[model samples]
Target: MKSLLSLLLASLLSVFSLPGLAQTPEAQSLLASVLALKPNAERGEAEFVAQACSACHRKDGSGKSAGNTPRLSGQHGAVIIKQVLDIRSGLRHNPPMQPRVTEQSLSLQTLADIAAHLQALPISGTIAKGPGSGVARGKELFAKDCAGCHGANGQGNQATFVPMVAAQHYGYSLRELEFIRDGKRGNSNRAMASLIKTYDQDDLLALADYMAQLPAPQRK
Candidate 1:
């Protein structure tokens, strides 16, 4: 009985202690800067195209391949700003994205605009299918482990800057999940890493498929 109580207390603490559940100082600063300027979705669209974001993310911000690059459509502007800052600051180690941050000569305003444009776009589209067997298992795992942070509908919690994962490409989601699970990605949340460690390759694929099949909620 003592052990059971201890375990429950530990679990509760873990939930509250997850990183990025609140905005960091850097993230808060970035959000302030972006908000200080008026976001122009039109300018953001031009900047996104000029930066060749469309090449990988597609013109609509829907990702190109399954389980690979994530769909950015309908993602919150604040989330986009935070990720851009993370990649720039090396908190997130995405090699391809690093150059865009450090060498691309894009200003903070451009980044803010791009984020606004992406957020304004709707996340409607067809997603690639995953193996049939793993989808059900994935749903179960997501409900048990992912939903608390990502939301029941996978819409993500904007207040915390969690990216929306619903209707994303399966291949992209799978690759990222693998990276986070394997500890290959930097700036990953410890709670997510711990949860993902229990999953095998098959489990990752299943979870990806389930998330990919989830419908995107209407933007408020």
Candidate 2:
């Protein structure tokens, strides 16, 4: 009986533990469109504020609230481009962001420009730290489960379009992890979903807080 239960658990774990899937055709097209244009970072910055992105993300893209809005500062241009496209296409569901991106009538060039400006911003800002939550346990889990793809320092791999997770808002990051774990997020990564499923709410909270305190990805 014990062997059977353990086998079942292992199988379930494997189901969620698959590697990241190949990039979608839509992602490829978005990348191609961004590369085809010459973006103006200055203009992009202006538009980002004018478009009300700063309302939730802050003028610097550091997120207005922890675990609710994400820190976009110093994130890779490729990752930002992919996420924006996903939101626009309804591959990712963000009600507040959807109308903003669509109603603004932003063109591909404009999108790329915004991405460029965001990438140029420094990744320094105030983020909420979880007090006496689960720092030690979170650090251990992060190194074991998260460091491989997100980097030892959470810098994220631009080539793979992984967003930098360090210094992100604790609340927002926790929300995203919960959403992915529950299969609520549309652009969910299967591997992450599976891994997150193993953690309880406290575990996720600890992880988010730990990540929020890490240094932001350094500029090249």
Candidate 3:
């Protein structure tokens, strides 16, 4: 499994060289392995707490906005798995998460379990929002630029690995948008980066605000 994971990491690195490319064979294999595992949410909850994830993400998975941490509650399990694997493989540059998301600390099964647990959690608690001034423009911008891929309601496509941005904190969203625009976020989708690069700071602020104000998706 470790060898397989190593190969997966190499495949992920190749993405940096070929943006918008299809997944490599090794990446597909790792995804299959993760999908094959029967995630144990109960065990995941324990690991979430034990791994000190609760410290930043909160016990409920409503992440800290002041810290620029994103809300993880109700996110798709596959998306979570992909991001964590990216972090572990150095495809994503998250220094704080790097230590905790190591291969030894989170094996594929444990990672899958954690993702399931987080996905099952309800998205509750107060989300930090942007100022009201830009909401109208933000809404317009969202319709014109973002709604196609992210959906009209920002309920991201789980199968495509697009994260649910509705109800996310404005501060975090703005920061990440800036990072993607500036090419600072290594794992960002190239198309998104290019599109966001066209936006000014105020556009980003409005976009983030609009996204933050969107209602959270109703979970079954």
lDDT against the true structure, per candidate, is: 0.78, 0.77, 0.83
The candidate that wins on lDDT is: 3
Residue 61 displacement in candidate 3 (angstroms):
0.5
TM-score of each prediction: 0.84, 0.85, 0.88
lDDT assessment of candidate 3: 0.83
Instruction: For candidate 3, write residues 1-220 as lDDT tens digits.
Output: 4553344445444543466535556665676578568889999999899888989999999998783699999998777998887788777789999989897877898898899899999999888888978889999999998888788999886656678999999889998999889877788887888889899989998999899999999875
Instruction: State the lDDT of candidate 2 residue by residue for 108-217, as single tens digits.
Output: 88888898899999876787666646878889889999998899999997656677888887778888988988887888777778899999988898888788888876
| Count of backbone clashes, every candidate in sequence | 8, 5, 0
How does candidate 2 fare on TM-score? 0.85
Task: Summarize candidate 1's per-residue lDDT along 122-201 as a digit string, tens digits.
Answer: 88666776776788899999999999989999998655667788888888888889989888777777778888999988
By lDDT, highest first, what's the ranking? 3, 1, 2
Superposition-based RMSD of candidate 2 using all C-alpha atoms, in angstroms: 9.9
lDDT of 2 at 204: 91
Model 3 TM-score, 2 decimals: 0.88
Minimum summed lDDT over a 10-residue window in model 3 is located at: 4-13
